[model samples]
Target: MLALRRSLIALVAIVGVVAGAVTAWVVTEASDGGAHATRGEAAIGGPFELVNTEGETVTDQDFRGRYMLLFFGFTSCPDVCPSALMDMSRALDRLADAAPAKLERVVPVFVTVDPARDDVVTMAAYVENFHPRLVGLTGTPAQLRAAADAFRVYHEKVMPETYFGGDAPERHEKGDYMMAHSAYMLLIGPSGGYVANFKHEAGPAEIAAGLREHVDAS
Candidate 1:
């Protein structure tokens, strides 16, 4: 749980840098802070459909035979999203070197919470910044919301005061908003059930270690 708190701290810091009007408390309040907690498997993960970067429709069933490391964020997220993707890539690379066979059974997935701005092409380009095997997914707002709910992930957009020129509640451009979401990397079992999760503070080595432990146990 401490690790999750740390992840939230880093996410809030990134949001603050992008939109000075955001505060750490605002982000903390937005997050449920229990994404990676030990809860009933029923509490997380379920059926959902979305489009991959290749414009192909995918679902939880498509990844049924492999472990899924999922992260929810947006392409517009300047720091947390990119950093988490890089961490996932590095963790996968470590796994490939240490346990090649186990690595083959793991899949890293990125699902965009802000689908309005992240289409198939945008997700394709954004995913390229990380691992070659990473799958980037985006879909309609309703579709994305379904997936987020299935995962019990929290996400919401905040219109920063800076966009309003320091005026309180003034109208701003539609795209001038920041997202506050959970920043944990969720690990789903091969059967599409909940396994465990790694907080951003865990970094590459810790993430790789967690994957190795879970994959070997199964």
Candidate 2:
């Protein structure tokens, strides 16, 4: 009985050690970056159905056979959104200057987080402020939410009272609001899968270099 008891205790100890090792491996994988990071297919980018500035319904499939430079922001965003969009536009221009032929292989997309105020006409005019080839998209709340979820983009409307030190903006009405959102320029492959993303701090040259690397790889 004593020997049997000892054997059972040893087995249990072995099992616990194995479980601990597995858990540690998973944690390391989750935290590790560089080549060890796990990037599964369709993990970052997923299917989404949205309406373009032209008032036409489109999906991820529509942009298939070409790369997509996707960005999510609202027209009312005064700083971060505009800076990122400018960087994206200049990146494309740089790429074009180096290899004009590569321009046709990629499409720059702007998705609005505030669809309530960003209709087709608004998006059309907003996109014109950036690159001519840039495409702006908006849709219903449900559609926008779905797209945001797929891309892991977070956005929320900030009331006027929250804009300053607990003081509302002058003439701010009930409907007046601003948005707080994640600002990252996502790069989708020609196969409609996520390739990479650039932070808003990345300048035009850096973004262009990174984008050029992907285009060359493709």
Candidate 3:
């Protein structure tokens, strides 16, 4: 009985060590970029049903056969959002002169993360400051969540006090909150597949170059 008990304990110890080793290997592989290594393409961009600036219902299918350059942010964003949109607009303008055919196939899109404050009228007024062809989209909270999740976007509302700490400015109104979101611009292929992403700091020239490259490749 003593020998049998000892053998069982030994077997359990061996099994635990093996399990730990397997777990460690998986963690190392994932950290080393093996998490996305197996897939042929990154899983990003999917079907989204939303409302356009004109108060028209739009969906991912509406952009079929056309490439989409999309960014996610709130209209009220003071810096990052406007900067990214302007860069995108400038890139499209460059493409218009450099590659008119490619520019025709591309569409710039802005999706609002703060649906509560960014209604159709607000989006309409906001997009006019960017590219002439820029399309602004907004929807209900649940609809927005679905779209954001499909694109792997992260967004959260921050209050003045929480964002500015003890010296936070007084709120202009009860709904006066700020939205924090990812600032990367995404390029989607004509068939609605993920192509590439431009960093938040990417300039208009860089974005245009990327767009030209990917559009030509597709």
Error of 2 at 160 (Å): 3.0
> Candidate 1: how many backbone clashes?
0
Tens-digit lDDT track for model 3 on 103-194?
99999999999999899999999999999999999999989999987876777788755444434555445557777566678888888887
Error of 1 at 65 (Å): 0.8
lDDT of 1 at 111: 98
Give the range of the ten consecutive residues with the poorest summed lDDT in model 1. Answer: 20-29
As a whole number from 0 to 100, the lDDT of residue 118 in candidate 3 is 93
Per-candidate local distance difference test: 0.78, 0.77, 0.79
List model 2 lDDT by residue over 17-121, tens digit each: 334334333223334453453324435567999999889999999998898998899997766778789999999899889767677788999999999999999
Which regions of candidate 2 are displaced past 4 Å?
A: 1-42, 163-175
lDDT of 1 by residue, 70-157 (tens): 9999998756778889999999999999889998899899999999889999999989989989999999999999998777677888
Colliding pairs, model 1 = none
lDDT of 1 at 142: 98
- Which candidate number would show the highest TM-score if scored against the true structure? 3
Ranking by lDDT: 3, 1, 2
Backbone N/Cα/C clashes per model: 0, 0, 0
Model 3 regions more than 4 Å off: 1-39, 164-175
Give per-residue lDDT, candidate 2, residue 59.
97
